[model samples]
Target: MKQETHTVKKEFIALMAILMSLVALTIDAMLPALSQIGTSLQVADSNDSQLIITSVFLGMAMGLIFYGPLSDAYGRKKIIYLGIGIFILGNLLSIFSNSFPVMLAGRVLQGFGVASCRVVSLAMIRDQFAGPQMGKVMSLIMMFFIMVPALAPSVGQGILLFSHWRAIFVLVLVFGLICFFWLHFRQAETLVPEKRIPLSLASLKAGAAETLKHPVSRSYMLASGITFGAFLGYLSSAQQILQHQYQLGELFSLYFGALALAIGLSSFANSRLVMHFDMAKLCHWALIVITVTALAFYCYVEVLAEQPSLTALMAYLAVTFFSVGILFGNLNTLALHPLGHIAGIATSVISSVQTFISVLIGGIIGQLYDASVVPLVLGFFFCSLSTLILIYRTRKTSAI
Candidate 1:
């Protein structure tokens, strides 16, 4: 019985992580191909290429609100199936895209489609776990999810070695199809008929109100957006910074993978430590680490008045992102802890708001790259500082 329960838990975590990875893979795997795709499509500016990344996020923000409510009303499995279908369609659109706008449109649709995977997975997790255990489970899920980013760029680069950039979409489409079948066959519907909320405007409004009205949820939700924006800034500019600026060229994936490994390790650590510490405290200290690291790096870079050595930049990023890994799971749990009854709507509103805010901030940061790490470091510092302010506000509330 014990082994059976453990096997079941492992399978559940793997599925959830893979579901989330569909989003990460779609985003990260495109990094290597951004330049190729941009040039192939005759983009006017190299910076504009980052739009390919942020556009998906924008679509996710637009689609997130609908998925949560729909999943709440319908059921988790059906919504997931629907999402995968849309994702497949998006990939096909991208595979056949002849222009930049068409590619962006396809990417947006891909994001919109996969938005179900993200929100529904979280909703299902909330259906099963709450409080610190939820945080632990999230950390465990992230442990696996982080591996996608670690390897996606390299996989993407490898694909480029033998095929056109469009082939990446074909790969993603195949992966999406496999996930769809896996969910259909292996995963049970977590939100049962009796527990499902009837889909209605009034119910959605109440759910949104309940989610935002809670002090911890509102504060952490904003904090998550701000912090994630910092991460997204790196994502958007990573190709330019690593390939063009540092001239790592073909070796860019290895460095990106190292930083991803740092984050993954921290997530694993958090999963163990959550049992011994408060989730809120973990997030607070993690933000403190990120804020301090970014601030010190910004100062160092400004004093040098040029791009810092690759080693210094890597050191700083590793520390900041490792801390970021700790914060991700904990902050999510803190935000949704009190909203389990409305997890579907709460996850939707929070995910939508955060993704929208992050995409805007990340888009600006990407545009500000300027062939130096200064903009990226500054973006990180400000975002972490902003999140620290919000986290402090949450502390003032007894609900925390």
Candidate 2:
């Protein structure tokens, strides 16, 4: 019985990882298709094409606000079904879209729908685990989750060779269907009836207040927002930087995949290490490493007024992403630690607030892209510095 239970737990983790990865798959797979989508839709400004990524994040931020509360009341499985249904509908709209606005609308709907998976997965995990164990599980989940991003651009590029950009949406729709069915058959509801909160405006307000009252949660949420803002900036501009600036073109997906692989490896390393060190200590060190690396990279590019060789650039990015992999799971675990009782609404509030802030910071940084890596590096430096400050302040106030 003990061995059987351990095997079942491993299967649950794998399923949760796949569910969470669907969001990354949606974004990263679209990277290789962005240019084609822009040209097909006759976008005027090349920069506006980045909106394909940003719009989804915006929709996710909005969707999280509602999905959290709804999932808290209704239970995880039902919410996931609704979310996947919406995700498929959004993909269908995008497949049929002839205009940029219509396609963006579809992407936004996809993001909104996908937000359920993001929030509910975390809530489900929280329902089962907490503290360092939660951090370890998240790291394990992220290890597998990061694999999707590493391979997605390659998948996207492959599809583009055979079909139009709209076909990418068709692929997403199919992926959603597989996930929906797998979830329906294999996963049981994690949220229990007695624990369900009443869904109402008053409950929403009360949950928000309850979540915000915790200083540790508030501080870590802010740190996560700042750190992810830098990541978001990178995602929004990675295609342009690799293909246009470095002129990698067909090799762009390979380079992007390599960077993602770095993050995956780091997440795997973090999973092994979290059992020894606390999440807070690991997160602190990771923030410091990323901040220092970004500063060095920014100075090297800004002072020399020359682009680093591809090898040099990748080395720096590898280090930055390695630290980022550590930071993400730990920061999220730290933020959600205090609100486990209300994990659904708490995860929603934390994710929504952080995502909205990241969208603003990242969107502006992406817009500032000037065929140079300086803006990207500076964005990383500032965001990591802000995260470090928050971490310092939070630790001084209380032991998390």
Candidate 3:
């Protein structure tokens, strides 16, 4: 029984990781194609191309607000299938789009649909695990999830070399189809009928209110928003910064992949280490590390007015991303820790709030890109500092 259980758990983690990776694959794979899509669509401002990324986030933020409660009322599996269908539709729409507005709309739709996979998967995991154990599983899941980003840009670039940018969407659609069928055949409905909540507006409002009333969860959610905003800023600007600023061109994917590998390695390490440390403490320290690193990088570029060599930039990014990897699983586990009973609605509300806030901060930072790394680094510094402050305040309040 123990051996069987262990095998089952491993399979579950892998499936969940693939589900989550769909989001990363969707976003990161589009990075290398942004300029091509922009040119083909005749975007007025070059910076506006970043909208291709943020639009999905916006749609996701909106879609997540509802998927949680609906999933809670229905069941995790059905909502997931529904989300997959919507995601496929969005991909098809994007593939057929000839204008920027249509493409943006399709991206938003894709994001909105993908929210089900993200929210439901987190909820499903929370259903089966909790505490440091939950952190361990999430770390393992993220270990696989991070691999998507590590290779997605390279995959996108390779596709662009041989085919039109639309091929990327086709790839996403094919990937989603595989996930859907695998999920259908292999995964069982984790939410029991007796445990399911009723689908109602009042219930959703109450759930949201309950989620907000928890000081720890609320604080962690806000911190997550701020931290993710910094990450999003990096994602939105990374292609331009690498290709234009460093003149890496096609080599941009290699550099981006290297940074992504740092995050994957750190997540793998965190999976092994989380069992020995408190998730909150790990997150607190990781935030501090990122804060200091970001501040140093900002100073190097701003006050010192020195352009860091490619080696120095990559080193700084690797450290920051490693800390970020540690924070991702831990912070999420912390936010969802207190609300496990209402995991579906809780995950939705928490994720939606965090994503919404992140989109605002991240969109502004991305738009502020001035062919320099100053805004990106400064965004990271301030966001991490704010997150650290929130963690401190939450800890103090919790002790009382």
Q: How many residue pairs clash in each candidate?
A: 0, 0, 0
Candidate 3 deviant stretches above 4 angstroms: none
Residue-level lDDT of model 1, residues 86-111, one tens digit each, is 88888899999999999999999999
Q: What lDDT score is found at residue 178 in candidate 3? A: 91
Q: Mind giving the per-residue lDDT tens digits that candidate 2 earns over 1-400?
A: 9999899889889899898888998899999989999999999988899999999999899998888889889999999999998988889888999999999999999999999999999999999999888988999999999999999899999999998877877887888888899899998899889999989999899899988888999999999999999999999999999988999987899999999989999899999888898778888899899999998888888787788888888999999999999998999999999999889999999999999999999999999999888889899999999889889888888676
Per-residue lDDT over 1-400 for candidate 3, one digit per residue giving the tens place of the 0 to 100 score = 9999889889999999999999999999999999999999999899999999999999899989888888899999899999999999999999999999999999999999999999999999999999888999999999999999999999999999999999999999999999999999999999999999998889888889999999999999999999999999999999989988989999999999999999999999999888887677788899999999988887777766766778878999999999999989888888999999889999999999999999999999999999888889899899999999999888877632
Q: lDDT for each of the candidates?
A: 0.92, 0.91, 0.92
- What residue pairs are clashing in model 1? none
For model 2, the run of ten residues with the poorest summed lDDT: 391-400
Q: Which stretches of candidate 1 lie over 4 Å from their true place?
A: none
- The TM-score measured for candidate 2 stands at 0.98
Alpha carbon deviation, residue 77, candidate 2 (Å): 0.3
Preferred candidate (lDDT higher): 1 or 2: 1
lDDT of 3: 0.92
lDDT of 1 at 391: 90
